[model samples]
Target: MSIKVGVIGAGGMAQYHIAGFKQAGAQIVAIADLNEAAAQAAAQKYGVAKAYGSIETMFAELPDLDAVTIIVPNKFHAPLAIQALEAGKHVFCEKPPAIDAAGVQQMKDAAEKAGKTLMFNFNNRARPESFAMKAYAEDGTIGRINSAQAKWIRRTGIPGFGGWFTNKDLAGGGPLIDLLHMVDLAMYLMDYPEPAYVLGQTFSDFIDDKNFKGPWGIPDAGGPTNVEAAAHGFVTFKSGQTLNLQVSWAELVKREEVSVVFQGTGAGGKIERLFGTDGLDETSIDSCELYTQEGGNSVNRSIVTEPCEDMGRSRSAANFIYTITGEEKPLNTPDQALSLMKVIDALYESAKSGKPVAC
Candidate 1:
């Protein structure tokens, strides 16, 4: 039986997600967005059965929505996910999980109470380069990870300046949440360790400056301009592992970077996804390399990786359906997402206090 999925939010992210579900052979039965035109347009484009202006109305009318993909803004993640879970629908939420730790915890509790699956859309982890590196760590080739460095730096690329993306209250934080995919992939490659503390610094120099912004998202001017444009932080895991993270939305760098390099006791590995000068689409090359010793001599090996398992976004939809149908165990569980949220919460708190914060 094909699973019936109702997608919420009809933005660029939602387009990828809907295509993924369709490619996975799941029926995109309905869609809902605050913008009615967006909802209707997405529904028509994807051949969805119905479109609604709100999730409440969609759920009330369509009583058999098996799952929902929540791709709205950061602020709606918790409330919307909880609502869907309570309505007896499995929730597939986007990255960062929620605005803060408490909000994420509420989503987790609601999922548990409703006995529904709550999964995060950490699709980058499903990329070929990333999963290949993950295999090495799981196989213990990169034994007992001690330290790692990761960066997802974008030069002059802040999303929706003066809008929710640059508003602390609306977006939770800036680059910390916006470009979290890099660190999330790093943590996934390291097997999801429990973070013990975080020390972070955030800068908001270009929040109101259009010169250092991109032309991707719709700008909502006249909103708050009080969020960081970049963030640098380090997390100490309870298992004595550490990771350094540097992410930015605005900078003067020559190029953009989305990369992570892990150093461990046995071997080291790296995953890099590069973009062009314009930073619109990813460049053709992505590298996944492993460093180890062969016959007592050091060797740097390039791991051969295929394209992302079901194309770019389909893997996430496939994995979620597998979880629903008991074919595969969920990799992005609510507990795992909550762990990431704890680290995020600590990072913000540490930035505010100018001191290390316990997760």
Candidate 2:
């Protein structure tokens, strides 16, 4: 039987979830959102059977929902995921896991209690380049990674003047949280080692500047711009591994770039995306390459795969469905999410205290 799915959001990200679920042979039975009109419209557009103004209503009506995919704002991720997990349903939540580590731990505990699968949309892991890089890391081609540098920097790319994207309470801590894909990817390639501490700093130089707004066209919602515009951090792991991360929604730079470069004992590899326009992955050029010595000479090899325009957004959703059906293992786990959130929380704390914070 096909998995019966409920989508818990009517926002822009919902479309990808719906499409990916349906493509993976799941039945998207309903969609729920606070805005009834938006929910109804999304249901119609996506050929869903039902729409509800609230998650409670949908759960009450669709008692047989096998799973739910959460595409809500950053603040609501943990609460909604726990609600679904505790109800005996598998959950696929969007990134950052939660606003902080404690919430992700709570969600993790809920899923453990319910014995249900809890996965986060660390979508970059689904990218072809990521797949290739991970293969190298896992198969001893790259050997043990000693250190890595992860960057998701933009020249002029704040989401908006003021709104959830800029509000610290709503979006966590801006690009350090929002653009954390590379950091996660780097850790994934390195096998998610236990982090020891984080040393970091944040900058909000252009948080309220309209000129630095991204090309996504999200209108100003007129709220407090309390989030940082950029962040830089270094993390040391208990296994003696190290990672450096730089993320920013707005900064002085040549172009928007997303990359994770790692140096391993046997070789070095890099997965990078250089954007022609900010926030549009389709317009960006991507490359994956490995550096090593062959026969006492320099050897650089390009690991090419089929192009990914959406940066594996829908594919990440599809992976959740595949995991539930036992066709594939999950790309991300709730435990890993807890650890990642701890690192993020520590980075923010470090940025605030101007000192290193234990993870």
Candidate 3:
């Protein structure tokens, strides 16, 4: 059976989801956005049959939709996902499932009541380099992991100056959410260990300063920006593993960068210089080098790059459909999303208080 999917946002990211869905052989049945013309344009572009100015109307018209993808602003994630789940549609929402813990909990409760699948799109997990790193960790190639470090740094990459991207209320935090791809990837490689505590800080000084010259050559229009341009955090896990993470939209660097290093008891390995272009046509070389603590020998492995596969968004969409059709187990349940949100909440609290917050 073809899975009928609806998209709730027609923005830049939505196009990626739409393409992934089409490539995965799912049906794009409907779409909705606050901007009706944008929704219509997306529907036409994707060959979807229906477009609506509101989600309520879209649900009413396409009641049989197998699943829906919520890609709207961060604030709307919880409400939109809850409504879809209550309507008996499985949901695949973008990362940082909700703006806060309370919203994420509500969405989880709704999914539970509806007995539906709810997935947060942690797309970074699907990258080839990420996959290879995860396999190495599980295979004990990295030994007993003790500490990990992940960083995503940019020279001057503030997104959508006057738009929701820079607005704290609309997008939550700036680089924390924008560059959370690394956070998700690092934690995942660490086997999603329970975070014992988090300590962090956020800085917005550069963004609002008039004399700021962005690292990426982006001009700094000095003005009030509500979001942080850079953030750093330390996370301690229940298994005694610790993670140090740094993310930034603007910095004193020349190019964008993302890297993860894992230190283990037996051996330590690192994946450095990882990132991808917008159209999926280009991606950073993912390389791993392993060093044995006991032997004092180093083995560097170059990860072969293949055509990037749209990591599981469409497959995740298909999984949602299969869950509804009784063909497969749920790919992402609401419980998982709630847990991810809790981590986000703790990270923010730790940042604000300059202390470790228990998760």
Question: Which candidate's TM-score is highest?
Answer: 2
- How many backbone clashes are present in model 1? 0
1-359: candidate 3 lDDT, tens digit per residue: 77788999987667767775665567888889999999999888877888999988988887778788998879889989988998998888887788887898898898889987777777666555666767777887776778889888866566545467677787777888866766766777676777788888888767754344332222333333688888888888889988898888777765667777888776676766544431122554445566664445565555564444454355554455555667766534556556556677788898788788998
lDDT of 3 at 293: 43
Stretches off by above 4 angstroms in model 2 are: none
TM-score winner, 2 or 3: 2
What's the residue-level lDDT of 246 in candidate 1? 93
Any idea what lDDT model 2 has?
Answer: 0.91
Model 2 is weakest, by summed lDDT over 10 consecutive residues, at 216-225
Which residue pairs in candidate 3 have backbone atoms (N, alpha carbon, C) closer than 3 angstroms, thus clashing? 155-215, 155-216, 156-216
On a 0 to 1 TM-score scale, where does candidate 2 land against the true structure? 0.98
lDDT of each: 0.83, 0.91, 0.73
Question: Estimated TM-score per prediction?
Answer: 0.95, 0.98, 0.87
**Backbone clashes in each candidate structure, one number apiece?**
0, 0, 3
